[model samples]
Target: GLLRIDHVGIAVADLDEAIDFYERTFGMRCVHRETNDEQQVREAMLAVGPEGGVVQLLAPTGPGSAIAKFLDRSGPGVQQVAYTVRDVTAAAAALRERGLRLLYDEPRRGTGGSLINFVHPKDAGGVLIELVQPAGA
Candidate 1:
């Protein structure tokens, strides 16, 4: 079953500037930041609201990165909506059973140590949807 909204991912040209803007405008503190080499991007996670909602800011590391491509085409904006799930593999299987297209055949390690997979935008009504199984489960 779905747990809650894990985070809303935003693609930006500069992670630092995006972090600063969110901090200054919304008073949101960035709780964590890291560069994921496998994903080829730098990211910062900001806490929002009282119940563990997060805003994930992503900046591509190079022109080859997906975020960079997205920025090139879309000009930096909401990239994906992530939802917490008990088991990403299970959720993915279910989605596949329902004829939904997944971006990858298997889940991969994502930021914050979670296992994650993306639902194809075309199948998800033009919005990328991420299914995340948190670190422990």
Candidate 2:
């Protein structure tokens, strides 16, 4: 079963620039930062408020990264929506059985130590859908 929204990912050309804008506009502070070399993206977590939702600032590290392509084609904007699920592998399998096109055949590591899989945009009404399973199973 799906739990809740994991977090919303925003693609940006410059991570620091985006961080400045968000902080000035929303008064949010950075809670964490890390680079996922496998995904070729650097991310910074910003707290929306106290117990508030988190905002992820993602910047492509190379031209081959998906975020790089997104920025090249559409500029900076909301990139993907991720939902927390109890079991990503099972959830993906079920979705696949229902005829959803998956970006990855299996779940992969995601930010905040979660397992994640992406449902193709073509199968998700043009919006990329991500299923996430939190750390420690």
- lDDT at position 39, candidate 2: 88
TM-score of 1: 0.96
TM-score of each: 0.96, 0.95
CA-lDDT, candidates in order: 0.93, 0.89
**Candidate 2 residue pairs in clash (backbone atoms < 3 Å):** none
The runs of at least 3 residues in candidate 1 whose Cα sits more than 4 Å from the true structure, single-residue gaps closed, are none
Tens digits of per-residue lDDT, candidate 2, 73-125, equal 98998888888899999999999999999889778888878898999988888
Over 1-137, each residue of candidate 1 has an lDDT whose tens digit, in order, gives: 68999899999999999999999999898999999888899999998856668899999999999999999999999999999999999999999999999888889999879999999999989999999999998
Error of 1 at 63 (Å): 0.9
Error of 1 at 91 (Å): 0.3
